[model samples]
Target chain A: MLLKPKTSILQKIYLPDIIIGLWITIKNFFFGKKVTIQYPEERRNYSSRLRGMHYIKTINGVENCTACMLCPTVCPAECIHIVAGERPDKEKYPISFEVDVLRCCFCGMCEEACPKDAIKLSNIYEMSMLKRSVYEKDFLLEQRGHK
Target chain B: MDFIDWIILGIKIGALLIALLSVAPVMSWVERRGSALMQNRLGPNRVGPFGLIQPIADAVKFMFKEDPVPGHVSKFYYVLAPLIAFIPALTTFSVIPFASSIEVMGRVVRFQVADLNVGFLYIFAIAALGIYGVVVAGWASNNKYSLLGSVRSSSQMISYELSMGLSVIGVIMIFSSVNLNDIVRDQGNVLFHLGQFAIPKWGIFVQPLGFLIFLITVFAETNRLPFDLPEGDSEIIAGYHLEYGSMKFAMFMMAEYINMATVSGLLATLYFGGWQMLPGMHTLLESFSLSGSLSGITYEWVRIVFEMFSFVIKVAFFMWFFVWVRWTLPRFRFDQLMGFGWKVMFPLSLVNILLTGIFIKVM
Candidate 1:
């Protein structure tokens, strides 16, 4: 059962109430500060820890990744594929690294799992692509993200 | 008519047509921008400076778009309906006086297009014809939703029009004239006698209850929000104009906005002081003119321009009010709308008329 509230004579005549409503709207229209941030010209600051685009951290001339297979092991989507090979300077380095971007959920687990802090998820969220993209080793190493 | 008179009339008609045509698209921009302002956001600021030219761009886009008629619909009524809707909306402005009469080129020129004795009735009768367009479009569409929308619109408009018509009776009774020009001229009189404290006899002051009723019914008649059951997108999926596209759709939109403009014009002319300014404003302007900033014929021209400007401002205020109300109120349920119209609005209008009658007799 529904209880209908008894309306007073003043309430039944809705003009006064409508006037009050109008007053509130007019006040807001003229005085209330808008919250819109125009995109392209303006951007919101994301946290440093935001799980965005994947990037391979580099220092000096060499990549930080030693290809321990930890990122691939921990990746929930199993998107990461690495083929470890020996180099002159490094005992283990990835000869090939691939990440199927569509399959990856950007959970930052691979970043967490990387012992060398090599595979970092940087604060670069715009990842729209015309076609399906798989991140190659050279492609992932580009300075495309804010750390 | 003489050659000069015909030329003057031609100029007036051309100016009026252009003015009426431009109001709809400008209102479209204002509605978008104003609603955005109320909701705390920027709307359409890219097309031009504050998106002023956005409506022009929109019209251009509508022109280029392909208009495909559905195979199932009746072709004749489908084509005719938009013209039917648009013509009446445009024509209703003919009877409305924008300002008091002024002398121009040695001839007295009234601001209105046609000063028929049955001015208000002409407005009502022309406005009433708009329902036919909606009904015809809906029926011809061969779509159930469109039919339902048209039915709802027709019934709502028909119902609300009774109260709307009745509300105007009070104004007519008070003014003792159906000619809108006379009604406006009458409004320039002092409202009441109170030892050096005279009020302007605005229709709003004289018939507050009638004004309220008229305001409400205008919203319903225009099929605006809180009374937009006919075109409720969520329920009826654009109602009567569901199958329409491109220029046809644009015509319907133009018709709706022009209806809004007409209502705003009427509201300003009837309740507000029409072209008449606030009590001291005209005297202030006259005093300023006497101070010798402008002299002779230029002064008359200045006054005429100022009066026209004031009329535009009054109409614009009511147009802004329409947008403000649209953004503020939620749509009403059909049953509740009908109930309110009959139960509340109808009886209240009668009481107002009765009281107005008694007041007129006593005084």
Candidate 2:
């Protein structure tokens, strides 16, 4: 159904409507609150559950991973790689752990698949880089994750 | 003219040219920032101090950029069009008085470049000539859109000029002078005393309808938004200046802003008491009491400075008003623009003239 807007004589003349339009703009110009965040100086807070860059969880200078290879098996992108090895203090540890960050889908499935809660996603979203790089185990152990 | 008179004329011309030229860059910045503010966004604040130097940076970029001449365009006329458009826009300011005359060294020095007896008429004539540049650019570019833009521009200007001229007829009737300075001086007279306060007989009070018509027509004359059909970006893709780039395009942009400033000055001079002190300025000047303290030459200088300051303030307000209106109203459709110009503004201005004539005859 088509609807026709009712028009008055004053509306037809248009001068009053123009004046009202101008008044609205002037009010916005003088009193309206600006919505710009001035990006470099300010940043917006995101939800804690946001899946961003990946990190490895460590407690008391030891990783929570038992080298169970669960994360690599569950990752949809097949980006994660791990090699289990025996260490002097631990029965099992990963000698090599790598995440091909460029292939990351950020699904958070690897975090869920890890039985020991060793692999996790953080809220640090600024992951831009000049060169493409894979996240190595040493770099991932920097404790950059908030959760 | 004597040697001193020649020197004074040279100074006036130089000052006016400098001020007019600077208005383009300054207004570009103001338009960007003002529109941004109106829309609740911060525009171009990354350059020097709220983007004050942004236009200068843009000018430098224009200067350094490659100015390619398209092979399809007519070479001579294409190069000549911007100059034609620009010179007339700059020249229209000569007859407009910035402030009243000051007696310097026993010889009167006016704040105008040339005080022509037919001042406003000179403006209309020169402004009409600016349309040639648009038409020539459109034709010379050898493009359909450019030609269409030029055609629209010429017709729009011609249609609106009639009403613009007719609207000011009321002002001329009330002020009884063609000279802008004389008209401004006449506007300073008190219309009536109401208790302790008196209202100055500005052109607006006497010819409200004329003022309204003139204000609307000035928008059309300057080819501003709601009347900017010539450069309707969505329609014709920048219209006449589509083929122009680098400094040539800059020249057209400069011509537009300068024309805006010139017409804004004209609007203030005709309607709002040009060079007359604003409402509270008289009391402010009285409180200073500089006339009693300062000597003859000094007092005259002070008075001239104050008047010039008032004129600048009025012109600035109108310039900002143009920007305000531009951001507020959407562009008019081509048909709506033409219809409004002929059917509405034309008849309204005619009625304004008839009413003014009757009022003058009765009084």
Candidate 3:
């Protein structure tokens, strides 16, 4: 169904309508609240569940992973690499862990697949870098983001 | 002219040129920020405070950019078009009086560049030539869209100029002079006294319909929004200046803003009591007794300054009004624009002139 708008004689003349339009714009120009956010100095808060950068969780300065290799096995992008080695303090501990961040799909499946709850996603989304590099174990241990 | 007179004339010309040239950059900033405000956004606040210097930065960029003459265009007219467009826009400001005359060094100095006897006729003549720039640019560019834009522009200007000229007849009859200074002086009279409150004989009060017609026609004359069919970006892709680059395009932009300022000044001069002090200013000045206390020369200087200030404020308001209306109204379709001009405004202005003539005759 087509609906025709009923316009009066004053509306047809257009002077009154033009004045009303001008009034609306002037009102907005004077009283409308600005919605711009200065980007560099101000940041918006995101929810804790936001999947951003990958991180390794630690408890009492020790690794929670038992070198089970579950996260790497569950990764869809095949971005995680691990080599397991034993230490005297712990019977089963991984010698090296790296996540290829550039290839990361950020699916959070690896976090879910980890039996020890060692790997977690955090909310540090500003990940621009000058060089392409993998996230090494030592670099991932800094705990820079909010989960 | 004598030596002092020559110096004063030189001063007036220099001041007017500076004021006209500076309006472009200032208006560009205002257009951006003002439109942003209307749209509920903050625009260009990064470069200098509130983006005031953004236009300056843009000017520098325009100056340094590569100015390539497209191989397809007619070289001579392409080079001449921007100059043709820009010069008339600046020249039309010569006849407009910024303030009434003041006594300086035993000589009367008028704050105008050239007080032509046919004041507004000179303006109309010069301003009409600006269309040549657009037309020539379109013809020279060897492009279909540019040609179309130029054709539209010429026709639009010709159609609207008639009604514009006719509308001003009412004002010319009321003021009884073509001299802008005399017209402004006439507007300073008290129309009638109602108890203590007085109504000055401003053109807007006596010639309301004429003012309305003149205002609408001025928008069409300047090729501003609702009448900016020539440079219709969505259709013609910048129209006549489509092939122009760098400083050439900048020249066109400068000419546009300058034309806007000139017409705004013309509007204020004709309708809104140009350089006449605002209401209550006389009472305020009298209450302070500044006129009685000051020496003759000092009082003249003070009055001249105040009048100039008043004129500037009026012109500035109209300038902002151009931006306000630009953001408020959407562009008119080409046929609608022409129809409105001929069918509606043309007949209305004719009626207005007839009515004013009858009113004057009866009185």
Candidate 4:
């Protein structure tokens, strides 16, 4: 459909319309409240259920992961590699647990699949790395989670 | 010229150069921070207090970065283009009076480098040469986008220059002088008086339509936003300077900002009262009895300082106006821009000149 531009003689003059624009900008410059957070000095709070970096939960210095295959089965990316082993104290434990961060889709299926609540998606979102990293079992445990 | 006159001339040139050179970096900082403030964001506030030293950091970064000249580009014009761009911008300021003359040791010193008898002509001539820089850069780059940008830029500038030159003819007629200093001095008298209220004879008050035409044309000639088809990032991908890098690119950026500053100064000088103190400023200065306490302080010197301050304020407002308009308005389509320049601006400026002539004769 073709439409004619809606312009009055005043607008056609251009000067008056431009002056109105100049007024609004000047008003904002002097009086408008800015919404900038100024990173490194101020930060926004994330919700409790916010999903970010991956972490393995621990209780009393013992890993809660029971080498449950449900998480790996549920994971769409198939990035989780867990090697289960029978130890002296524990009936079943993950001897070698690795998460290929490059491949992981960050869907948080592992957290929902864990029956023991051993795996979780933390709110610590600063996960930038210089190289492709595979999160080892040792690095996944401890109080590293922000949430 | 005598020995003292030569010395004074050298000092004037040096002072103007230093002032203009320093303003480029300061303008970069202002543009960034001012845009951020208007858009509800903080821009470059990490380097120093309110990011005051951000331009310095940017300069350092640009210095360390590797500059690569693309192999396909013509080597000679590529090297000369930035110099051509920069020199015109710097030289335009030589004729613009920053402040009225001050008496120092019984000698009169004007706050301008070289106030040519025909300063308006000199400025317009230098400005006309500025298009060559963009055209040369675009043609030498051997890129399709650059060539298109150059073509667009040259056409746009040429079209607007006609209206701009025509618009100023009204002011020239009213002032009866081509010298900028004389024009500025001519604006000092009262235009009209009704009872106690008086209107200072500013160009904006008398030749308002001409002023409007001149203002719009200046923005287009400077290749600013809403008319910035030459450097249309979305369309031409950095335009004429697409192949330029490091300091060569920096020089173009400097040229652009300096051009902006010079235009703003000219706007203030030509339309708003240039270096003329705001109304009642002299009375306000006289009301203060601080002069009696100081031994050698003269009221003339005090008034000159006030006038200089007023000039600075007007120029600064225009600078802010430039940045403000840039963020507010969207870019004009190439055809729309040309159409407006010829069809709208040209006829309007001609009408303005006609009205001014009739009014002058009748009055």
Candidate 5:
């Protein structure tokens, strides 16, 4: 694990970083202020270009997803899977679909590679779940968030 | 016997006042200066030539600042907290023996105030009392963060006090004296001279491990770097004194600095031979032109002055050292700090005591 020469006379078996860490503390204490910046008064700066949570675009309740299987192949983590069936118009559409977000690497390649532009990756990153199964959702309804 | 001694008493009182005042400001300056150097930055140089009168400016600002009491707090305890923090810090110095006594105007005047046999015990008791102020400050504030900080501080200090007391027991056995002067006197002994070098072997040499343990314990007790968990600025927001402002906040700080100075002085007296020059240096000084005995009153005055200088130099060096160490080390985390004190320091202290016993018997 060590980068230094093995036969070097001062090659210490134990790392002495603990003492160095202490010294660093001493340095910071003297150098920096307590910096109890009033939270409301002093807001941390965020870049304007930063993408946040996702939003879905819909026209009169019609959506673009179209049960595309192309997204499933493009996902690096193999998180996307879709089951398709014939609609009343005889056009094929997805009957069942699931995104195993637990396995998702979030590379966003699936959205970019979609040929029909039907799938889009959401900007949302604040997702949390107590159980892995909770992340394995059955549907993608936006406004009605999960309990 | 008459009018002049009355004048002399006034002069002594004036001197003591001056001494205390100078030490206070100088200690502040030293702390800031040492911190600056340690941090690789310039400290307080704007006012009065490298911030010499900074303490005066600070004192003035404190005096003029508006005092506030939150409606949720207990007025009595809030007001009392600062005093509790400040008093014990200054009081512990009363038993210190600075130097030897000499005859002045046909009367013997000791260099120190009353020396108590239980001097070290008195220090322990006084320092322990400081926790009460911190605890009460937290409880009276009605702030969750401050309350938690105060509780943590009182508990941490109380727990470490055991190891602190245990660590110093070896010194007690070695010198068998709680009176600081006696401790210094015992350490001044030289069994033999080594060629050109005289050996008045300091306590540090004989008990390096005890010295190390004592140093670590004192750092925790004084609430300084690495051990300053109570005042963890980031996580705790000024700890017990978070709710306090103006002069009250200033008082807590003043107490902490005074504790630093007090502990540093105690360290010097305990391990570094109080005011005495080290062994070879003592011999070298003896070899100088003034080698013979002196019986005159002038000689007595000269001796007193020199001894006082020795004590001052020793105490000042140790105070500087406290700042040096503060800048040289980092703070420990809550869990790590507790682990270090209880698991590491306490056990090592017991082992040190055993080793000291072995050394005493074998040596």
Candidate 6:
């Protein structure tokens, strides 16, 4: 086998990728719309089916939660915690109930497992706080007009 | 100081400030838009009309973002580098003839900020000094990539500058004047006859090859397209500016656009007959009929304003052209790039000089 040294040297490296990449980019610049989305004021619309932050609701100044642990049992992230207490007046209903905001995975399984329509996923995704405790939104209904 | 001199000084200072400030942000938008257009896409349409507010948003982001300085950087020089980078970019614009002179408040106002006898040389010298900023900034960065980038930028500038300088030499030789204004005037006469049409003696016609060489060299020097290896983001991660943050980075951005403006101005002056209108446009405008408002300004002032607008339009076209080429051409490899510059561009420029000399001597 007789291979010329110059050809061998040339064949060792064919560095046309950079140039070709640029050409393609240049072609694309004239051909396609760039996908850098401007954020904030011009927001991307989320799909209706998109899962987001969990919100607990109650009507007639009562929480629908009955110290249920069924929803927490199915959560994968182990990001939820609950504490419950039996009501002194009503034997069937539990009085005290707590859900750790930090631990809750915002999964719809929690909403699905609720005996009543107590837990729901809201469209609100931007949830931030200065402290971990500040993220804790109390589930109790407002007494009169007070929160 | 005399009131008229004060007026001139005020005009000069004000014009510089406005031009310097406005061009930076506007060019950024132009770059993004031009790039998108070249790629057949709409870029940055959300902020303002055609993404005009993108620059503003970017400025705000820069302002609000926390300033970070690398601990490894040479603290003083790193901080000082951007100022050095930007100052020289504006230095060339001092000689750029944007319009003809006009009488303002009984005082004659020249379009340019300054017209040094060494106008052309001053531009070259100032432009050359800019490499120092890149070199220092790169070294001060104390990073391998930035150092490499700076070194590459300096070498590239030095190499292409030879060709660019030589190209200008031909123009200077042919015109027999280094004054930018005089060169434009020299090109006013008809170079060739084509029946009813007299081809204006533009530098493009006189030295087509030289003009091409000059254009290519300017592109390289300004680090736009095909020759943007210095800041090749994919590999180098913004190169010399990798460590910069806040306003420091903004200065570099400002410097690049200003360089674009400087080169555009130079190209307009050197090749496209500066602010001189094409013969047909001039004739049409002269014979035009438009209802005039009752303004006190004379015909000469209006003409000055008109000429200024033309200069701006020309510069803007070149700016867009830079972006167009940037999206059009692929970058050359390091060695191929060097070879093309030293081996190809250098020789071509030398040949251009010889040809120009022969043409000038014989014709």
Q: In model 2, what lDDT does residue B102 have?
A: 83
Pick out the ten consecutive residues of candidate 4 chain B with the lowest summed lDDT.
B288-297
User: Which candidate number would show the highest TM-score if scored against the true structure?
Assistant: 4
Q: What DockQ do the predictions score, one after another?
A: 0.74, 0.71, 0.75, 0.73, 0.10, 0.26
Q: What is the lDDT of residue B230 in candidate 1?
A: 93
Q: Name every residue pair that clashes in candidate 3.
A: none
Q: TM-score (chain B) for model 2?
A: 0.98
lDDT of 5 at B87: 85
**Each prediction's TM-score against the native?**
0.94, 0.89, 0.90, 0.95, 0.68, 0.77
Which residue segments of model 5 deviate by more than 4 Å?
Answer: A1-147, B1-18, B278-295
True interface contacts reproduced, per candidate: 0.74, 0.84, 0.92, 0.66, 0.21, 0.47
Model 2 DockQ reads 0.71
Q: Model 5, B1-363: lDDT tens per residue?
A: 588766665665566545654576677877886677556566776679978889888888887899889888888999899899888877776666677767765777655555688978889899899878888898888888888888889878977898889878988878887888788877778845789665665678777888888887898888887778788888888888988888899888878877876787678778777766533444444454276554467565655556667777877877776676666666777888788778878898999999999988987
Off by over 4 Å in 1: A144-147, B292-296
* Best of the two (2, 6) by lDDT: 2
Positional deviation of B85 in candidate 1, in angstroms?
1.2
Give model 2's TM-score versus the native structure: 0.89
Q: Rate the local accuracy (lDDT) of all candidates.
A: 0.90, 0.90, 0.91, 0.88, 0.72, 0.78
Candidate 2 lDDT, B152-217, residue by residue in tens = 999999899999999999999998899999999998999989898888998888989999999998
Instruction: Locate the minimum summed-lDDT window of 10 residues in model 4 chain A.
Output: A138-147
Q: Candidates sorted by lDDT, descending order?
A: 3, 2, 1, 4, 6, 5
Instruction: Please give, for residues A53-105, the per-residue lDDT of candidate 3 as tens digits.
Output: 88888889897877799998889999999999988999998889999998899
Candidate closer to the true structure by TM-score (higher is better), 1 or 5: 1
Docking class of 4: medium
Candidate 1 residue-wise lDDT, A4-87, digit = tens: 999988778776787888888778789979888998899987787788888898888688999999999999999999999999
In order, the TM-score of chain B in each prediction is 0.97, 0.98, 0.98, 0.96, 0.90, 0.94
Minimum summed lDDT over a 10-residue window in model 6 chain B is located at: B287-296
Worst 10 residues of 2 chain B by lDDT: B287-296
